[model samples]
Target: MAISAQAREILDIAVAASEAKLGINPVALEVTDRMPFTDVFLVVSAESPRQVNAIANEIVDELIKHGHKRAKMEGKDEASWILVDCRDVIVHVMLDEKREFYALERLWADAPEVPIEVTPR
Candidate 1:
């Protein structure tokens, strides 16, 4: 399944927002074209659960601010990993420990990585 241009654009914006708001290192944004529900999957990690929650909320806010409402949200309470669904794109914001435990990258190793321009915020 090829990713639509709109999905790619939203994924890019989410990535930028996560980086800017949380300052997380080695943030992994994965795009899975094969997923039937969504065209892209963004997996980002922070150092702590608090940062994970912050990044997730900020990303959702930014996406909505740009006219993309979140379709669904999960795991916000625990803050270990928060999943934000935006129809064509589903974002997973996780702490380092949770990210490693889930290993979303390895799960979707076949998907191609999108080129992202990382800027400090």
Candidate 2:
């Protein structure tokens, strides 16, 4: 199945929120076919642990403001790789080092990327 309109809207909000915190290389993967639980996976990188949490917090805040429930959160304590579950969109906010190590995009290479129009800051 293709990504839902609601999921795409959530992804836009999440991407904008992350970019507000200077989140790097934000990539959205349409994973409705691979993952039964969610429709999209938003992966973003940060320079430090502090930035990681900031990005994740901003995303969650924006999602909630848009009336989308914040389903779950993980790795906030470590801040190395924080996962924000927002129903149709699961956001991954990770430090640069962790992002390079995990290579989520590489792992999910088969999944088609959802193009995001990033505003230059």
Candidate 3:
């Protein structure tokens, strides 16, 4: 499924924010048009819990500033994983360990993979 322009824009911003703050491996932001609720699903991995939380927060701020109203947020306290839902897109920022355990990429493997441009810091 092809991602809409709006969804792609949001995904780009989220990936940029994650790269700026966390500087982990090039974050993976996937666009899954198969989902009924959200048009995109962005998955980013951090090296540690603190980095995970930071990435999540940065993405949320960027999204809100870009005119997206927050739908919901989860897992801020533990920082094992954080989910930010903005109706059209859902962003997942997780620690490396958590990301491996959850394997979200595998879960949504059916959706077409969108190429995420990696920028060096």
Which candidate number has the best lDDT?
2
Q: Give the poorly placed runs of model 3, Cα more than 4 Å off.
A: 26-33
What TM-score, over all chains together, does every model reach? 0.85, 0.96, 0.86
Deviation (Å) of 102 in candidate 1: 1.4
Residue pairs whose backbone atoms clash in candidate 2: none
Is 2 or 3 the stronger prediction by TM-score? 2
| Steric collisions counted per model | 0, 0, 0
Summarize candidate 1's per-residue lDDT along 17-104 as a digit string, tens digits.
8887664553333455366677777787788878887888888888888887665789978888888888787888888887789888
Q: Which 10 residues in a row give candidate 3 its minimum summed lDDT?
A: 23-32
Best by TM-score: 2
Better of 1 and 3 by TM-score: 3
Global fold similarity of model 3 (TM-score): 0.86
Give Cα-based local distance difference scores for all models: 0.76, 0.92, 0.77
**Per-residue lDDT of candidate 3, residues 2-114 (tens digit):** 77788878878888888888646543434554667777777888888888888888888888888977547898889888887866678888888888899888887777667
Where does the lowest 10-residue lDDT sum fall in candidate 2?
63-72
